[model samples]
Target: MAEKQIVEQVLAAPSRYVQGKGAIESLGARLSEIGSTPLLVADDVVWGIVEEPLRRGFEEAGLPVTRVGFDSYATAAAVDELVEAIGSGGHDVIAGVGGGSVIDAAKAAGHLAGIRWASVPTAASSDAPTSALSVIYTAEGAFEEYRFFPKNPDLVLMDTQLVAGAPERFLIGGIGDALATWVEARATARAFAGTMVGDRPTRTGTALAKLSWEILWEHALDALEAVRSNTVTPALEAVTEANTLLSGLGFESGGLAAAHAIHNGLTAAPQTHGLTHGEKVNIGTLTQLVLEGAPARDIEDFIVFTTRVGLPNTLTEIGLSPQDTAELRAVAEAATAPGETIHNMPFPVTADAVLDALTTIEAISRRVRAAHGLAEPTPILTP
Candidate 1:
């Protein structure tokens, strides 16, 4: 039995990971070996920030490259643009370098190439870089269904220095997204039990998700300090990796639960449309915990960690008001779609209960934000 388990563990999708300060500079050579003249897809913001270094890397390695710039929107249109750029030119490989948007676009582009992709993330905001799935949005920026592919990334390159140097909000958002792994994975495991697909819910994925949560809970403060101080503390590195790589791979294969479902509900609000992906997911995680009957202490611990890290602890921050009860109800209903996140909860959840949880979550988030002297809650939108 133990031998069977060991054999199963060895069969998971493999990703070549490279981590360090100057790791990004070596990407051209590393990717060139796998495929000459790889297509590079990056958001405009990333190009402005890291283009010079990347250009130098390509020049130094004498690698042929085709660069495609995206506007940092992961919309279907953007994906189409990327595919068009990669074209029928027959590039040997595709590389996505930037945040989740660029990575998602690159992932889709590589899929179009009928080949594996190398993901280079400039921010640790979400797990998009490491997943075989792409959360493509509609052209108008509405949440769309997850797009699954036959394979995961060919490589995951993490330049800790570049990541540490990027805006602190990215890491905070990453933490927000990373926090969902344990919450979501556990919920899925409980719902489907041993029926989890393919070596997915692997003991490794489950263990990584739990450890990611623990690292976030215990070291979030230190991570925030590192971000503020512009230093890569060991805690920050661990948390960053968890958010960018581990959590991503775990959730893609392990499965999602109410946390992401709650995030999906955010699209119902125009105000939430402007928020970062992980930021919305952060609040969703809190709301999911409430639905899961998590203890007050455990939930509070999550709230405190989020509060310290600048994540939304309340819906009011995302622009939902008390009087928006009607809108919240509609959103809750949408979250309970069949085989969706809300249904994945271990306990039964009604739309009304979901509404109440959202209200509680919003209120708590506001209080935590206020106490930390963060942004004030804003008024909600009404027709």
Candidate 2:
């Protein structure tokens, strides 16, 4: 048998990112730089907020525009519908405006239609804006699979004012999503896992991941406060960039590990239905630390950071009861399933190991909360 060759490294990012208070107002000009005839896709709520400005801007720029409404999940059917619409209209560019689902649908549609695409995020909810990937779910909202595109979006435009005005939960959810970047990337580097970008982790990706983590720890609280007040402060801007741009590039080029895999596994439990992706990943991040036997100081620091920013540190917070052995085992099994990203860990991880980590993390979280004089720990049911 011959030894297999390993590719060295890969890095991927959007062609450009423009972010500020009035970034959306420049959408027409940005589109003109790429194509003259563009199609806009957004959900009802997003369309309501952005319609006038977008229409005015495109008209002023003398660009032809076609608008479509996306009100369903990012299923293959939805993408196909958008693709047909774009093809029939002879639109040259695709612009997605809204949250993760809307942006993902537009990206998949544009990829299928062979058109350049742009992402305009209305909230800082997840790191889905800058990546060259889309997560397709069943129409019923169950996890299906991730689809990778040939190239990243041509543009990612974020209006900080819009992001700030979004519900605070979305911002915190974004923080939780960004929170796992450094931890997972470090594990991926140690395991020598391939990134979503298709090769080994790049120095640039790892550096960005580290920077994202540092910014979250330094500015997350202030940013949360700023968003609550509907004000765009420097801290808010930094965290938004960290959660969207840096985390997007970092995760795509650096790779994913146990945290995200655990998140996927958690979806198997119906109790987690109400939790956001970042909220679930928040618990997965802590669970990963426990699985890796991370140093106590490091674990405590993360617990403190999550607690300060109102991220879920225990299973109960995410709607899982500790005593549900069968459900917990299912989650663990899913996490360790074949082809799951949990394999990206530096060491071999088993379902049993993940189960044990889940229990231990609950105990650790309780202790940390008690020591901090925060709310009393929820009673853990012995398995």
Best by lDDT: 2
Colliding residue pairs in candidate 1: 313-365, 314-365, 315-362
Sequence-dependent TM-score of model 1? 0.89
List the candidate 2 regions with Cα displacement exceeding 4 Å: 1-6, 377-383
In model 2, residue pairs whose N, Cα or C atoms come closer than 3 Å (at least 3 residues apart or on different chains), thus clashing, are none
Q: What is the alpha-carbon lDDT of model 2 when measured against the actual structure? A: 0.88
Residues 169-222 of candidate 2: C-alpha lDDT, one tens digit per residue: 899989999999999999999988988877899989988999999999999999
lDDT of each: 0.75, 0.88
368 Cα displacement, candidate 2 (Å): 0.7
Model 2 poorest 10 in a row by lDDT: 374-383
